[model samples]
Target: MALITLTSDIGQQDFLVSAVKGQLLQINPSFNIIDVTHQLSPFNYPQSAYVSRNAIKNFPDFTFHIVMVNLFERKPQQLLLAFHKNQYILCADNGLLTMILEEKPEMVIGLKLDSNAIKNTLYCAQIFGKTIKDISEGKSLLTIGEPDVPIIEKNHLRALLGDNWMEGQIIFIDNFENVIVNITRDDFEQQRRGRSFRIVFKRDEVIDKISESYADVSEGEKLALFNSAGYLEIAINKGNAAGLFGLQGYLEQTQNAYLQNRLFYQTVKVFFE
Candidate 1:
């Protein structure tokens, strides 16, 4: 049986996910439906991208993963389906695809659904269900829609550097309240070669010193470190870093908020003595 995975901001408190599953089963009863995650922060694309990126590769090859966060954000009312590194992914064409792909897709196709025929989350049942059914039945992607507009490709987040610092805003706050920055560890380490740097949250609170592990600091002590996924993380040992630091992850707007009782970090200066 072909496996289909679902990830979305749709909370489990409702019947959204079940309805999608029902639609899939109706189309192809023998197919397997898996849930990667349903607790994603609402409309948070970076979090969705990060979670999907880490999760998709673990599934078997030929798995179809669907991400349905913020499907109505942009125009053209389209969805994205692509195959990358032996996995198939379906999501809105917002930067989510580009963020995860990190490069051009092996095969990229846009899915044009009858917006009128399928409205609300129920559309996943109708549109996505039909797509998956077709694919399992040996239908080509080109059979779904006409050659539509090309996909928009761009990096939504910024990378931090040692010699040249790039500003990155917090893009996600997971349920654990760990703030996920737009900056990746690679860019941070490349620019920070042994220089002392600081991460400032709201009210000018500075977090200095990178820890080798979460246990490197005593209980209630905050530390900056590279997470297992190789992303720079700001966390407190056995405590809530976001609560202690009053840091807000994923800002809705970027303005002088940095100046208004907000956190700001000095540019990481890299100098070889």
Candidate 2:
């Protein structure tokens, strides 16, 4: 059976998510549908990219991954079908493709939609279902859609680095309220150069060392550690780190007014000595 994974911001409160699955199954019963997540924060690209990138990399080759976050960032003209590292991704033509992959895909094709038809979530799923059906039947990528089409490109979120310091944005906050930063272990090590470091956030709170686990610290004490995904995480031993610290996830400001009133509440900075 072919594996198909779904990642979306559409919550399970209504029938929309299951209805999309029904559309796919109606077209091909052999597809083994998997749900990656249905609760991604709407319009939060960095969080979606972080989750989708990690999940897609672990799936077996030739798997089809569908991302439905921010599907209508603009009027939907066509969808993107990307093949990278032997797996397939189907998503909107929005700039999210580059954000998730963090680079160009091996191949990308624009899947056309009927202009006359009402463009909605279910209609989009129907188009994706037919395309997946065609590809599984061994249809060439060029035959299914237009090749070498121009796609919207967006840069991935990266940490700000300096000679003695690194500033990382809060990308995700887990169910337990552990705050995940954009900095990876490799980034920290290279910059540290065996020097002592202090992880600082929200102005006054500081952690002088990284812990291997939450239990390394006393209950309710703040600690920093590299998460399973290799990103830096700030947590309190059996407590809510984000809520207690008043840390917020990074948000992209769309207006100039928001930029003028900028605050680094969502940032964590590390200084090496």
Candidate 3:
């Protein structure tokens, strides 16, 4: 059976998610479809890339990831099929492929879309499904897709650094309302340089040390830790940190000054001392 994972921005409130899954199953009943997530915020590329990148790395090699986020960001000309680090990713050509992979894939192909086909989520799912089926049945990737195609490139979001401080954006807020920042462990350590640091967020809240786990702190006390995905996470033991702190996830909004101030408040700043 082929292992296929689905990630999308479509919420679970409607039938579209299930309909897309049905379309995939219709193409290959033997496919083992896994849902990474469907509740990702729309057009939030940083959050999508973070979740997709972390989840894709955990799956076994050869796993097919079908990303249905931002499918109609532009007129659909082609879908991207990328083979990176022994895994396959199918996503819209909206620069998400590069963001998730953080680099060029080992190999990439452009799966052309039919101009006449109703360019909906289900149709795109069908196109991806058939391509996976063909590859599973010994079809050469190059034969079915246009190789060496130029794809849209978008850089991964990174922390903004100063001489003594680095600022990170809140990328995700989980079910428990713990906030995940974009700063990775590697980034944190390299910047720390063995100095004591303080993580400041929401203008006034602060965490001075990185804890091993949420349990390291008293219940309802805020703590900072490197999450399983190796990103910086701020949580309160058995409490809702995001809600309590009023920490909102980062959004790339630049239009309104009010939203810009809100975005600034959402950032977590680490000062090395």
- Span of 10 residues, lowest total lDDT, candidate 1: 264-273
As for TM-score, the candidate ahead, 1 or 3, is 3
lDDT of 1 by residue, 78-139 (tens): 77778789898887777778877676788887788675664566775567777777888899
What is the C-alpha lDDT profile of model 2 across 1-273, one tens digit per residue? 668999999999999999999999999988899999999999999999999998999999999999998999899889999999999999999899999999998899999999899999998899889999999899999999999789998898999999999999999999999999999999999999999999999889999999999999999899999998899999999999999998888876533675544446789999999
> Which residue pairs show collisions in model 1?
162-191, 201-263
lDDT, each prediction: 0.70, 0.92, 0.93
Ranking by TM-score: 3, 2, 1
Candidates by lDDT, descending order: 3, 2, 1
TM-score of each: 0.82, 0.96, 0.98
Instruction: Give candidate 2's error at residue 50 in angstroms.
Output: 0.5
lDDT of 1 at 132: 76
In candidate 3, which residue ranges exceed 4 Å CA deviation?
Answer: none
Pairwise TM-score winner, candidates 2 and 3: 3
Angstrom error of the Cα, residue 200, model 1: value is: 4.0
